[model samples]
Target: MASRSFAEEDFSCPVCCDIFINPVLLSCSHSFCSSCIQRVWRNKTLKECPVCRTTSSNDHPPVNLALRNLCESFQQERKPKSGPGVCSVHNETIKLFCLDDQQPVCVVCRDSRKHTNHRFCPVDEAVADNKEILKASLERLQEELRRSVNREQKLCKTAGDIKVHAQDTETQIKDEFKELRQFLDDEEAARITALREEEEKRSQRMKEKIEETSKQISSLTITIRDIEEQMKTEDVSFLQNVKATLQRFVFVSVLLNSNHHS
Candidate 1:
């Protein structure tokens, strides 16, 4: 009795304050009844160990088979009474489960008219079958979840690629515009240089033409003065000067006509 008491104290689940039922092991090596742990963490966002408060990294922790076996062995040694779990209606031990009604029923209820044409199974068998169905469903849900995550990742990568492509296109456009602007600037500089050179050439030609016209005017004035001084002298001197003055006048008339044509 003393050993049994000690074992009960050691094996009792912390959450339920009872012997472990379907114990599961966490990463921290702590053990608890599956139902008790689920209840503690139910509707919670973060999964954590109830005893140590350590966060669990795994979505589903493994079952503690050794601990479960120990709990079963301990219960068997304790020799639980059959009457405590008996059906109140039939006054018999509940050994079978009603598949249609989804409840436990005694042998009398199984044969009764209320359960007519209904499927039935032993309690242990029903538990095992239900567990299998639940496990298969869980696997299907997990597969769907994994597919959703993969799709999300692919979409993110595609979006990133599109952004990078857009940036590259923008840079190319800017570079092309820069080249165009530089070409325009260089063309403007060349045109301005050509215009300045043409202006300088035109100005130099005008200066040369002005100097030549001034020299022609000075020569004409000197010829006129010589003719006037000779006219004041005697008739023979005036006649000799008249021939030179006529030649000078003809030369000045030809120069003025040439200048007008130019």
Candidate 2:
């Protein structure tokens, strides 16, 4: 494969613009770094190919094993050889470290006037010490990352809880409003019923008053007719019944005054 040359871009991921790391293939025949594709799809509703924008059928796309092997081979071929370094000053192999100068040096440089009084240590020891320091730094960074991750998780949980609380509060508000609406409806009905009952009572009283007035008017009319008939009688007959007629007239006058006052 190395004999058949290929461009670096051919093995690169479109999303990361770097050599594919754990490449995954989509059904659309496009590939991307697994982490890059997952990052792109994190906030999206549908999984899709990054280059083609084609929807993916599977959530966990298959790893491109052939492409991965090729990339690994390519990386190995491109890696620089780590042979013993040559000293710029003595042109000898660098095998020691100058503690005072803080630089790698050849054995010949250790005896030179420039490093005569400088402390020295083996390159291996220096390397081991530096690795230990780096390891400590890496541990601190990992601890901080863990704390950050835990905080983020807690925040996400709180957000979900807040959403649930809001839904519950909204439901409670709706239920309270429904109860208030029912109460108002009942109050309005009661008021209307009371008003209707009062109106009926007043109407019944008015009807009774009208009927009594009609009967009084009818009685007055009959009395007036009787008096007129008596007036039409012969002179001798009218004179003989004058006293009874006067008494009836006085009774009618008293009835009219009573009716007027009432």
**TM-score per candidate:** 0.33, 0.34
Report the C-alpha lDDT of model 2 over 2-106, residue by residue, as the tens digit.
Answer: 414877778888986667889999999898889888888998898978777799998889999989988887766664432236564335667787778667777
Model 2 pairs in collision: none
Question: What's the lDDT of the predicted structure labeled candidate 1?
Answer: 0.64
Off by over 4 Å in 1: 1-93, 181-262
Residue range 1-262, candidate 1, lDDT tens digits: 4325455767778876667889999999999888878888889988899878899987678899988887777766555433434654445777787778766678878886568899998876765655454344344434443543554456556555555665565566556556676667676556556555655565566555555555555554565455445445543233324445555656765775586467
- Residue 219 deviation, candidate 1, in Å? 99
CA lDDT of 109 in candidate 1?
Answer: 82
- Report the Cα lDDT for residue 253, model 1: 57
Please give me the total number of clashing residue pairs in predicted model 2.
0
